[model samples]
Target: HVVDELALLSANIVEVVHDRLSSNVRAGTTGVTLSLETEDQKHMDKLIQHLKEKSIDFKVLT
Candidate 1:
C-alpha cells in the first residue's frame, strides 16, 4: 500500500514537472534545465529508488 502511494505521488510530481517544462519550452526558455532539489534529498532519493524498483523510467533533466 505504501509503495502504491509512493508510485502515485511520484507520477503526479513528474506530471507536474513535465507540464511546467512544457510551458517553459513554449515560452522560448531555450536550454533550460530541470532538477529536483530539496532540503530532504533523502526523500527524493527514496522516491527515485522506489520508481526504479517499480520499473518506471524517469528522465532527470538538468
Candidate 2:
C-alpha cells in the first residue's frame, strides 16, 4: 500500500526511465523497487520528502 501511495504521489512528476525492470516478479510481491530519473533536483527533493512523510526507509544515490 505504501508503494502504491508513493507511485501516486510521484505521478506525472518525474521521468520513468524504466518501469517494472523484472518480468519474473509475481503478483502481490511485497518487495519491489521504485526508481525515478530526472535532471530536476526538485523531483528528488519531493521524493525524499514523500518518503520521510510516509516514514519509509530509503536510500538516495546521486
Candidate 3:
C-alpha cells in the first residue's frame, strides 16, 4: 500500500527502493527504508511535502 502510494506520487521520482538493514543479526533487520530519488528541486519539494502530509520520518541526503 505504502509503496503504491509512493509510486503514485506526482513527483519527478527517478527511482524508489525498499531497503532493509542487515547487521550482524541482519544489516537491515531494524526495518524497511524507502529510498526515493528525484531529479530536481521541485520534485524534492513535492516528495518532502508528501512525506510530511503522511507523517513519515525522512531525511534529505543531498
* Sort by TM-score, top down from the best: 3, 2, 1
Worst 10 residues of 3 by lDDT: 24-33
Winner by TM-score between candidate 2 and candidate 1: 2
Best by lDDT: 3
Which prediction has more favorable lDDT, 2 or 3? 3
Residue runs of model 1 more than 4 Å from their true location after superposition: 1-39
Global lDDT scores for all candidate models: 0.52, 0.59, 0.61
Q: On residues 1-62, what C-alpha lDDT tens digit does candidate 3 reach at each position?
A: 55555666744345555445445235634444445666668877887788788887556665
Per-model C-alpha RMSD: 8.0, 5.6, 4.2
Give the lDDT ranking, best first. Answer: 3, 2, 1
Residue pairs in clash, model 1? none
> Which stretches in model 2 have alpha-carbon errors above 4 Å?
11-34
lDDT of 1 by residue, 1-62 (tens): 43364655553333232343554355644433335443366777777777688775455554
